[model samples]
Every structure is written in C-alpha cells, then in structure tokens.
Target chain A: MRRAVGALLRKDLTAELRTFESIPAMTLFAVTTFVLFHFGLDRSSLEGDLAAGVLWVTLLFAAVLGQNRLFVAEEEQGGFDGFLLAPVDRTALFVAKALALFAFLVVVEIVAVPAFGLLLLGPDLLDPLPGLVLVLLLADAGIAIVGTLVAGLAIRTRARDLIAPLLTLPLLVPVVLAASEATAPLLAQAGAEGPPGRWLAILAIYDLTIGLVAYGVFDFLLED
Target chain B: MQAPAILVRDLHKSYPSIEAVRGIDFEVARGEVFGLLGPNGAGKTTTVEILEGYRERTAGIVSVLGHDPGQRPRTLRERVGIVLQGGGVYRHVTVRELLDHWAHLYPAPRDVDEVIELAGLGGKQHERTRSLSGGQRRRLDFALALVGDPELIFLDEPTTGFDPAARRAAWQTVRTLAELGKTVLLTTHYLDEAQALCDRVAIMKDGRILTIGAPAELGVGALYRVVWRDAETGEVQSRETEDPTGLLHQLTSAALARGEPLRDITVARPSLEDVYLDLTEEPSAAASQEVRDG
Candidate 1:
C-alpha cells in the first residue's frame, strides 16, 4: 500500500514538474488575486480581520483552481482505469492524490503568503510565523481531502470545470471559516498572537472527519 | 479440473428504463480466448464491466476465477487485467514512467521494459503519452493491462480503430497470451477477428445471447453458397446448397460436356459475419415495438 501510494504520488509530482500545468497557474492566480484585492479594497495595507479574510479567501479560490484540474489527467488519460486494475487498495489512490494536492497547496502558499505579506499584510509575518504554519497545515489538510473527493465526483461529469468549484466550495466552508478566524489575530496590527484554540480544534476535526469519509467512499466513485 | 476463469449464470442488469442485460449465461475456461461478439448497445460492455467488478449486476451469479466479482475482492482484482474502451493515459508523462508507476500497483508485476516491448512500444518509451498517436496510445493501454501479469484479461473492443497491420499485430499478441496459459475475454464487432482468435464465441443482440458456439458451428448448418457465370450468356448465377461438393461435381461435368468451363465457380460457407448480421437485425424492429409498447 505504501509503495503504491508513493508510486502514484511520484508520478503526479513528476508530471507536474514536466508540464507546469497546475502549480504555476495556481501560484500566479493567487498572487494576481492579491493584487486585485489590493486595488479593489482601495487599501495599501490590510490588518486584523480584513487581512485574514483576504488571505484565506484568495487561498481558497486558488485551491479551487487546483482542485478543478486534480483528476483531469486520470479522467482524460485512462489513469483511473489503470489504477483501478491494480491490486492496491483503492484508498491508496485517495491518499496519494490528497497528499499531492497538499504538496501543491504548500507550493502555492510558499509564493502566495509572502506576496500577501509584502503587499497587503499590516503586521510582521515573522512575528506569527510558527502559529501561522500550524494553522495553514491544518486548513490545507481539510481542503486537500475534500478537494480530492469533489474532484473524483466532478471529473466524470460533463460540466467538470464548473461542477468542481461548486461542489468544493460548499464542502470547504468550515475550513475557510476556521482558517480565516484563526489567522485574523495573527495579522492584527495590535500584536501577533497564536491562533485561537477552538478554531484550530475545528480545523483538525473537520480534516479528520472528511479524510475518513473520503477514504470510505472513494472506491464507489471509481465504479463504471 | 480447474474452475472456469469466468462463470456467469442468469446474469441481468437493468437501468431505470432499459434492460441492458437480461439473464445471460456464459462460461470461459482458463487458458481459452473467448470472444463476446455484439453490435453497438448489445450489453457486451455491461456484462464485461460486471465481470470486471466495475458495474453491479441487477441479478444472477457472476463468478470470476471462482470469486464473486460484485464484492471486488483484492485477490480477484490482482488476477484480472482490463483494457477499457475509453479513458486514456497521462498525456504529460512518458510511456516508461506510466508503465513503471503501474507496475508498482501490483504485487508481482511483469518487467516494465518487457511489457513495453511486448506492447510494441520499444522505441517510444521515452516519449510523453500525449505525443503518441491513437494506435500508440491503444498499445500503451494494452501494455498497462499486461504489466500486472493478470491471469484473466478483459479487452473491450481492443482493436476498434487500428489499421490492418496494427490489428494483425494485436491479434498475434492475444494469440501469444493464450499460448502463455492466460485466459482472455475479448469483445468486438469484427466477426473475422472473433473467428480468427476465439476458441468459442457468444453472439449478443438486444441484451441477450443470440447464440453461442464455435464460429463455424454458430452459423446455420449445411448452408454453403455456390456462385458461377453462364458461359454462353455471360449471366451470373448463385445457389445455396447443403451438398456443395456434389453440386460442384455435377456443374463441372455438365459444363465440360458443353465445351465450356463453369466460369467463376466458387463455393463458400456462411461466415460468422453473415450469422451476426442476421441475428442482430432480425429482432430490432420487433424489439423496438416491444420496447415502445411495454
């Protein structure tokens, strides 16, 4: 199972590196959205709730872009059928895809968060770096799991590009709610602080619950 | 003494408004190449998918390698390989990369290089799948199916779009697999292909098995066709006969006495193609009315 997951993840990462299909588009979309937000809000810098809201919303939308393309290779290229024929547990695919999406999210955030810091954030990003990392890790897990599930559901549909975002956004509301609420204090102009414990708890719980559910149901979606 | 590779009894599958497969039964022995011949929408795909554990049967028992495919046990999947009708490869990934990745999914996969060579993808291993032509992509699909070294392989219309040469190459590969003691279940509309490769075939029409047997025996018995031209009038003549040899002897003798050869004399048996078209076409108009009136 571990070997299968590793192989699948490696294939996805290598393909991404060669094609530059998803990550660059996502990263560029994130940075551009920040620029748009800066102009749209008519503010040189955002602080506290406004800063948190902008960063999380931008990340969410960018993540949606990645999710839209998640299973496209499999859907278009017969990757799903090949994978299905394998003896490995079907959940191995779910785990591999979720991890790959998480890695892509990390790459996107590596660029987007700094852009957020440079352009829109009023507070010092370094002050809350450790706490911010924890919040991002937890929030990204929830998004990754839910994103993979939604991608599988929508990829086979005729309106895949449209259905992906529509299905994912509703399922990701809790992740957004908890992530934004948690990051708001970290970006406050007054002084940076750790994320609130309840929001962290919410993020963790949502991630765990969704992960288990996705693991259980993923095989059914692969059926003809 | 071994169990049949596939044993489907009274199998049935129905959509909300259509009975796609209605009580069909067939068995394929191990190491045999069995062809499921049908026209479009004849429930060939549904039955194959059910056996592959990709679709649920509405009713009846399906045993693939002695296990119920409906449960989709890992053991059964490990033993069965499938080449689906559609859904292709990762366009951005090289052929070698995709093969290597698929190899890791099975417990004991065939060597990636060997599979690449077997599928006629030797020199193109480094090329991205998207760069491959249609025939090349189908070869890649074939390579992926064999990489697992499955005991039973399901090929759904494996050569629908191949050129003549490629089709012959695929047939050779299927023949080699059968020689290697692997069981193959092939679905195709090409009667000649079925006749050439299959040890036995099941002809399907309107979600039912119209007939099942060796291709030669499946056609109506003693129905040989003789065609010739009248030497004097230059008019063509034809007849269907049970005794082609006797008829040929009498025709040639009479023509010799007349000092003219029996021009264009040829005797042929009814082909699998003839039987298939007859079986599938005979029921359509009546079946449509039955469906409409149901």
Candidate 2:
C-alpha cells in the first residue's frame, strides 16, 4: 500500500508539473477574486470582518478547478484501464489522488496568496501568513477528498462539467466554514490572535471523517 | 482437490429494460484462454465485469481466484488484471510514470523496464501517453495489466481498433501470455481472434451461452460441398453432401462409363465461422416477438 501510494502520488505530481494544467486558471481565479474583494470592501465604511470568509470561499471554489481535473490526469490516453489492473488497495488509490490534488492546491495558493496580497490587499494586510496557510491547506484537503471522488464519478458521466461542481460544492461548505473561522481573526486585523487551533482541529476531524468515507465508498462509485 | 480459476453460477444482471446476463454458468481452468464470443449488446461486457469484480451482479454466485468478487472484491482483484473495454493508458502522464505507477500497485510486480519492453514501449517511455498513437497507448494498457503478473487476466475487446499489423502484434502478446501459462478470459466480437487465441470458446446471445467447445469441434461434422460443370447446359451447379469421397468416386465412375469428364470439380468443409453461426443463430421458434403492422 505504501509503495502504491507513493508511486501514484509521484505520477500525479509529475503529470501536474508536465501540464501546468490547474495552476494558471486557479491563480487567475484567486487573483481576480482578491482584487474584486479588495475593490468592493477596502473602504472604511465597507471593510468588514468577512475577509477570511471570502478568501476561504475563493480558495475553495478555485480548488474545484484543480480537483475536477484529477481523474483526467489518468484518463486522457489510456490510464483508467491501467489503474483498474493494478494490484494496490483501492482505498490507497483514493487517498493518493486526494493527496496529489491537495498538494497542487497548496502550491497554487502559495503563489496566489502573495500575489493577492501585493495586488489586492495591501502587502502587510495578512501578517503571520503561516496560520492562514494551515487553514487553507486543511480546507483544501477536505475539498480534494470529496471533489476527487465526485470527479471520478463525473468523468464517467455525459454531463461531467455540470455535475462535478454540483456534487463538490455541497460537501465543500463545511470546509469553507471551518477554514474561514480559523482565518477570520488574521484577515480582519493587522495581526490578531485567537484559538484558530480549535478551528484547525475541527478541520482535521472533518478531513479524517470525510476522507475515510470517500475511501470506503470509492469501490461503489468505481464499479460499472 | 484443485478448483477452477473462475466459477460463475446462475449469474444475472439487468439494465432498465433488459437482463444482460441471465443465469449464466461456466468455469475456466487455470491456464487456458477462455473466449466469450457474442455480438454487440449481448451482455459480454457486463458478464466480464462481474467476473472481474468490477461490476455487481443482480443474482448468482461468482468466485474468481477463490474469493467472491461482489463481496470481497479487493481480495480477488489484487491477483487479477483487467483491460476494460476502453479503459487504457492515461494521457497526461508519461509512459514511464504510468507504468511505474501501476507496477507499484501489485503486491509483487515485474520490473518496470521489463514491462515496457514487453509492451513494446521502449522508445516512447518518456513521452506523454496522449502523445502516443492509439496502438502505443493500447500497448501501455497491456503493460499495466501485465505489471502485477496477475494470476488471471480479463481482456475486454483488447484490440478493437487496431490496424492489421497492430492486431498481429497484440496476438503475439496474447501468445506470450499463454506461453507463460496465465489464465486469460477474453471477450471479443471478432471471431478470427477467438479462433486464433482461444483454447475454448462459449458462444452467447440474449444473455445466455448457446454452446461451448473447442473451436474446431463445435459444429456438426463438416459437410463437403461439391461443384461441377453440367454438360449441355454449360452452367455450373453445386451440391452439399455428407460423403464427398464416395460421391466423387461414384460421379467419376459414372462419367467414365459415359465417356465424359467430371469438369470443374471442387470440395470444401465447414470452418469455425460456419460452426459459430450455426451455434449462435437464434431459433425464433423459442422467441416470442411483439409484432406490429402498419
């Protein structure tokens, strides 16, 4: 299982590097979302405590672009049949794919955050960015787990584009709420401190619970 | 006591309106190419998927490699390799990456390079799978299916779109697997492929096996067709008879007696396709059709 997970993770990461498939679109989405947030809410009267909520919401949606393409990485040429033929545990297949998407979302957010900081929010608006990064990572992992499964199902359907996001977003709301709560303090202040760790714990539990659910249910979805 | 590699008893599956496989029964030995020959929409794919542990059966018991496929699929699948109808190589990843990825999934896998060589993808190992031709990608699919060195392999229409040269190469690949003594369950619409590769074949229609046998032994004993030129009419005539040798002797002796040669003589026997059609042709006598006239 370890070997299978490593190989699959490497395969997907390498494929993402080869294509640069999701990052550009995700980056553009994050940047424009940031700019729109700043323009609409930067004023003294309109600047609100919902900056973190908006940011998490933006990042969560951007992940849909990344996650929906997960199975496509293995689907384009002839990979689906190969995957079915492999001897690995099916649950490992689900986990490794989710991890790969989580990693990609992290990479895009790493760049997008700084770019968003410079271009939209004043450069110093989000201080101690590491905590927010943690929130984003956790939330993104949740999104990827559910999104990856839905993407797997949707890719097999005739109406994939319409169905993937529909299947993904409903599961995404909990992650978005938890992550926004975790980041709200910092997003609303020059530098604020609260028990963001509690929110992180909630995010972790959701990830563990939802990850297992998706893993256990993958076989049902994978079958004809 | 040894057991069959695959045992499917009274299996059944249905879509919204049709039962694709209705109470089918069969067993495959450990080292034979078992052919499931049927026309399009005859439920071959559904039955193969059920046997591979990739689809749920509506009824019946199915055991592949000693585990019930529908109940404990992973236990069965780890030892089974499958090339589903069109599920082949992934396009975005390089060939090396895809093979290496699938290779790692097996409990114990063959060398990745050896697999690439086996699949004939040595030169294109670094190319993106999408960049390879249809045939190359198919070779990659075969490589992945072969990676785990599975005890049983399920190939569903493995060479559907291949050109002649590619098809022959794939046949060679199948021959290699048989040489390795691997049990392969093959489903195909192409009778020639069934004739060339399978040791035994089961002809099916409307979700039932019509007959099963060694290809050559399938039909009623071969009938010989005799053709000859008729003297005054100048038109050739043909006839089928069970005793061609005796008929030929009698005809020639009569011709000799009449002082005329038996010209344009021809003799032929039934081939597998003839037997296949005979075995698989539906007897509408058993079928009740809903007829409408305008």
Candidate 3:
C-alpha cells in the first residue's frame, strides 16, 4: 500500500512538475486575488480580523481552483479505470490524491502567504510567523481532504466546474470559519500570540472526520 | 477438478426505468476464450461490468475465479485483469510512465518494458498518450490489462473502433494471451471476431442469452442449405435440409448416372452472424414466454 501510494504520488508530482498545470495556476490565482483584494477594499493595510478573513478567503478560493483540476487528468484520460483495475487497496488512491492536493496547497501557500504579508498585512510578518504557519497548515489539511472527496464526486458530473465549488464551499465553511477566527489573534497589531487552542482542535477533528468518511466512501465513487 | 474461470447463473440487473440484464447464465472454462456476443443495449456491458466487480448484480450468482465479484475480494482482483470498453489512460504521461505506475499496483507484476513490447508499444513508449492514435491508445489499454499477469482477463469490446489492420493486431494480442494458457472472457458485437477467436460464445440480446455454443455449432441444429443448378435446364435451386451430406450424395449420384456433374453445387452453413441476427432481431415466442414466466 505504501509503495502504491508512493508510486501514485510520484506520478502526480512529476506530471505537475512537467506540465506546470495545477500548482502554478493556483499560486498565480492566489497572488492575483490578493492584489484584487488590496484594491477592492481600497485599504493600504489590513490587520486583526479583517486580515485573517482576507488571507483565508483568498486561500480557500485559490484551493478551489486547484481542486477543480485535481481529477481532470483522471476523468479525461481514464486514470480512474486504470487505478480501479489495479490490485492495490482503493484507499491508496484517496490517500495519494489527498496528499497530492495537500502538497499543492502547501506550495501555493508558500508563495501566497508571504506575498500576503508583504502586500497588505499591517503587522510585522515575523511576529506572527509560527502561529500563522500552524493555522495555514491546518486549514490546508481540511481543504485537501474535502477538496479531494468533492473533486472525485464532481469530476464525473456534466457540470463539474460549477459543481465542484458548489459542493466544496459549503462543506468547507466550518474550516474557513475556524481558520479565520484562529488566525485573527496572531495578526492583531497589538502583538502576536499563539492561535486559540479551540479552533486548532476543530480543524483537527474536521480533518479526521472528513478524512475517514472520504476514505470510506471513495471506493463506491470509483465503481461504475 | 479446477473450477471454471467464470460461472454465472441466473444473473439479473435492474436500473430505475429498465432491467438491463435479465436472468442470464453461462460458464467460461479455464484457459478458454469465451465471447459474449451482443448488440448495443443488449446488456453486454452491464453483465461484463458486474463480473469485473465494477457494478453490482440485482440478482443471481456471479463468480470470477471461484469468488463472488460483488465481495470485491482482493485475491480475486489480483487474479483477474479487465480491459474495459473505451477505458482511458492518462493523456499527458508517456506510455512507459503510465505502465510503470500501473506495475506498482500489483504485488507481482509483469516487467513494464515487456508489457509495453507485448502491447506493440515499444517505439512509442516515450510519447505522451495524448499524441497516440486511437489504435495506439487501445494498445495501451491492453498493455495495462496485461501488466498484472492475471489468470483471467476480461476484454469488453476490445476492438470497437479499430481499422482492419489494427483490429487484426488486437486479435493477435488476444490469441497470444490464450496461447499463454490464460482464460479470457471477451465481449464483442463482431460475429467474425467471435467466430475467429472464441472457443465458445454466448449470444446475448435484451439482457438475455439467446444461445450459447461453439461458433460452428451455435445455430447449426436449425438447418443446412444445399444450393445447385440443374445442368440441362440451367435453373438454380436451393433447399434447406437436416441432412445436407445425404442430400448432396444423392444429387451427385444422380448426376453421375446421367454422366453430368451437379452444376454450381455449393453447401452453405449459417455463419455466426446469421444466427446472431436471427436470435436478436426479436425475442422468439419461447424466450418472451420465459421472460413473462420469470
């Protein structure tokens, strides 16, 4: 199972690296959206709750862009059939795809978050770096799990572009709420403190619950 | 004794508005090539998908390699290979990369290069699948199926859209698999393909098995045709008979007695296509009665 996951992950990462398909588009979308946010509000700098809201919302929508394309190769190319016929456990595919999405989210955040700091963040970026990283990673995990599950469901439908975000955005509202609320304190101009433990717990519980549910149901979706 | 590679008994599948596969039963012996011959909307794909464990049966028993496919037992999956009709491969990846990735899915897989070569994809291994022609894509599908070295392989309409040469090539690959002592259950609408490749075939229509037998024997019991022309009158004549050989002997003897040959004499046996059309054109009275009874 480990070997299967590794092989799949390597294939996806290699394809992404060669084609520059999903990650670059996602990153570019994130940075561009940040610029748009800067002008939309007509604010030179944002802090506290406002700053947290902009960061998570921008990242969430950008993550949706990556999720939309996550399973396009599989649906268009017959990757699902190829994976289904193999002897490996079906959960291996769910794991590999989720991890691949997670990796993409991380890569996008590396650029997007830092860009957010330099562009519109009023607080000293270094002050909140540790807590902010935790919040981002947790939020990314939640997005990756829900994104992969929703992507699998939506990819086979006729209205995939509209369906993917529609299905995912509602499912992800809790993650966005928890992540934004958690990050608000770290971005406060008065000082940087660690995120409240409650939101982190919520994120962890959401990840675990969704991850298990996705793993359990993924096999059924793979079936005809 | 070893069990048959596939044993289906009184199988049925139903959708919301229709019954896709109505009670059908057939068995494929070990190491034999079995063809499920049917037309569009004949429930051929539905049955094959059920056997492949991609879909569930509404009723009846289906066993692939002695295990129920509905259970989706990993042991069964490891032993059976499936090449689905219109199955897709990744368009952006090279042929070798795709095969290599598939190879890792099985515990004991065939060598990636060997599989590529076996599928006749050696020269094009480095080309992205998107660049492949339709024939080449079908070959890649075959390669993926064979990579697991399964004991029983399911090919659903393996050559639906191939040109003559590519179709012949696909046929050769299937024959090669049979030659290697593997059991194959193939579904095709082409009667010639079934006649050429299948050791035995089951004709299906409207979710039912119309008849099942060796291609030569499938519709043979019905009648044989004797065609000839009268030498003196130059009039062509034909008759359907249960005893073609006896009738031909009598005609030849009479011709010999007259010191002349039986002009334009020809014996015509029903091809599988002829039989398939006869059975599938419309459900016979007896078959419809059976459906009503069920």
Candidate 1, residues B1-294, lDDT tens digits: the string is 888999999999999999999999999999999999988999999999999988999999999999999888989988998886545477777899988888899999999999988889999999988888877877888888888899999998999999988798789888878888989999998988999999999999889999999887876684899999999899999999899989999999999898997889888877888888878875578898999999
For model 1, the chain A TM-score is 0.98
Alpha carbon lDDT of residue A61, candidate 1? 90
**lDDT for each residue of candidate 2 in A117-156, tens digit (9 for 90 to 100):** 6655432545647666677778887888988888888988
lDDT of 3 at B130: 81
* Clash pairs (backbone) in predicted model 2: A77-B91, A78-B88, A78-B89, A78-B90, A79-B88, A79-B89, A79-B90, A81-B87
Off by over 4 Å in 2: A42-51, A74-85, A122-127, A149-178, A187-201, A205-224, B8-16, B19-25, B41-43, B57-61, B229-236, B255-264, B282-294
Q: Where does candidate 1 stray beyond 4 Å?
A: A158-167, A170-173, A188-191, A194-199, A220-224, B14-18, B86-88, B217-224, B240-245, B274-294
Best by TM-score: 1
Count of clashing residue pairs in every prediction: 4, 8, 1
Error of 3 at A86 (Å): 3.1
Candidate 3, residue B80: the lDDT equals 88
- For each candidate, report its DockQ versus the true two-chain complex: 0.63, 0.55, 0.60
Q: Tens-digit lDDT track for model 3 on B171-253?
A: 98999899989999999988899999999999888899989999999776778888999999999999989899899889999
Q: What's the chain B TM-score of candidate 2?
A: 0.87
lDDT of 3 by residue, A24-93 (tens): 8999998998899899999989999999999999999999999998888888767787777777888898
Worst 10 residues of 3 chain B by lDDT: B84-93
Error of 2 at A147 (Å): 4.0
How does each model score on lDDT? 0.90, 0.78, 0.90
Model 3 chain A: worst 10 consecutive residues (lDDT sum): A76-85
